[model samples]
Target: MQLNQALEIFMHGEIGIPSAENRSSRQQLAGLDILHSDDVWNQQRQIADEAIVQSHAPAEVLALLADYQPSVDHRITLVDRPTSEHAAYHAAGYRHSASEVLLARSLNNLPAPDPRYAVAQATTIADMEWLNTHDPAKRAWLTVTRLLEPRLRHSFIRLDAEVVARVRVCQVDPAHSYVTNLYTAPNYRRRGIAQALMIAVLQQAAALGECWSVLIASEAGLPLYQKLGYQPLATLTVFEPAEASE
Candidate 1:
């Protein structure tokens, strides 16, 4: 079986589609593709919501997400830029920019602050105002914040003086971590703000007694994560009804 095919099965199974598990079991036997780390919070959210709607208890839903949260949830979006092109990672402009995104690492090793830049963790979830800005790229901040409050078991933030450049960091288990739903305000890329924050997230994890962290780095972000000590674990894709078009 091909990696893509295996990935499809894993994703569908993870979403609670019955047949997906049986098929995925076979794909795993073939060692065709590795299970993904960061499956993103949205997929799990949808599955849990469906279950809750079907009559499961809220506590049960919370248990499952906390226990089996995807090992990785990572994304990169334009938060700000000199030009739309300058703000985005892809050649396509800031089409992917959004309010906030999730980032994961198995470790947290925030570098020492240099004179030019600094990195610190957000004091609290309520204090993320700098991240939820009026910039077009950060327009989704409120939405993202609402999405995370109930869903995430844990989280972290990276800040620069008054700016919040990275708004996510988390782990599903003591040893497994995932990243996703990541975004950067337009004015803050290629400046090492994100890199520093990501390091802080990982270092914090280590200090708290974690040994490994994980995340799904976007295509443009693969190299940066590599520099930060992340390696490819798997590539996953999800298929679902098109809510907007439907």
Candidate 2:
């Protein structure tokens, strides 16, 4: 899939349908598509100029973002394929805050699941709550549980009666699946829980005839993904206003 199209699908799955109160507004400025969601969650607002047209003045993008509520400290993702737009953001006082490497692999021969972990689908609110309780940051994604499009699936692995690891997979299309929110409790890390969980998820995706799996891996997770046979396709940079960096 095209990078921009994959990005749009990834963001939609990540942000879901913004609540009525945090609904986003969009505008085209200098060939840049900007989305402003007054959501306290930074991921809800973003700026993307995937086409590299560079027609939009960076000042205009900054000015528009400044209007967002709690804008100074709130973060936003700046999707620029051509590095040329980087200077505009720097001039606008947005700092390079974080980045993720995009990775993809053809689901040809997935590894066998480790018997040490048992993976199962999360089927109810209680199941999701269990996941968030173990990793509070996941609470922000409660909205994804309510989304119907793209066929969301949540899977978890339990040890004795406690959920120890979790992962979310979105079937973006019959031929593609996106994985996100893969988390294993601190106590459970390095015990093969994550690898096992991923093996199970990808197996399911393959069963559904999905041939490709895509994900944005953090620096720490890069090695594991590489070991799983995913190769870097691109890099996505996220920027935050200067104040937010401070």
Question: What CA RMSD would you report for each candidate?
Answer: 14.1, 4.7
Q: How high a TM-score does candidate 1 get?
A: 0.46
The C-alpha stretches of model 1 lying farther than 4 A from their native spots are 1-116, 134-136, 139-164, 237-246
Number of colliding residue pairs in each model: 30, 1
Residue 215, candidate 2: Cα error in Å is 1.3
Query: Model 2 TM-score?
Result: 0.74
TM-score, per-candidate, Cα-based: 0.46, 0.74
lDDT of 2 by residue, 116-227 (tens): 7778886776765665565424444434323333377888887866667777897776787889878877777898889988999999999999898888888899989998
Per-residue lDDT of 232 in model 1? 52
Please, what is the whole-model Cα lDDT of each candidate in the order they appear?
Answer: 0.40, 0.67
- Give one digit per residue, the lDDT tens place, for model 1 in 1-246: 233332232233332212221122111212212233322232242112111011223234234434544222322222122232332223322123233212333354545533454544444545445444532243433333333442232223344443545544444445544454455556667877666666666666677666665555556777677777764544322211123223
Model 1: ten consecutive residues of lowest lDDT: 46-55
State the weakest 10-residue window (summed lDDT) of model 2.
46-55
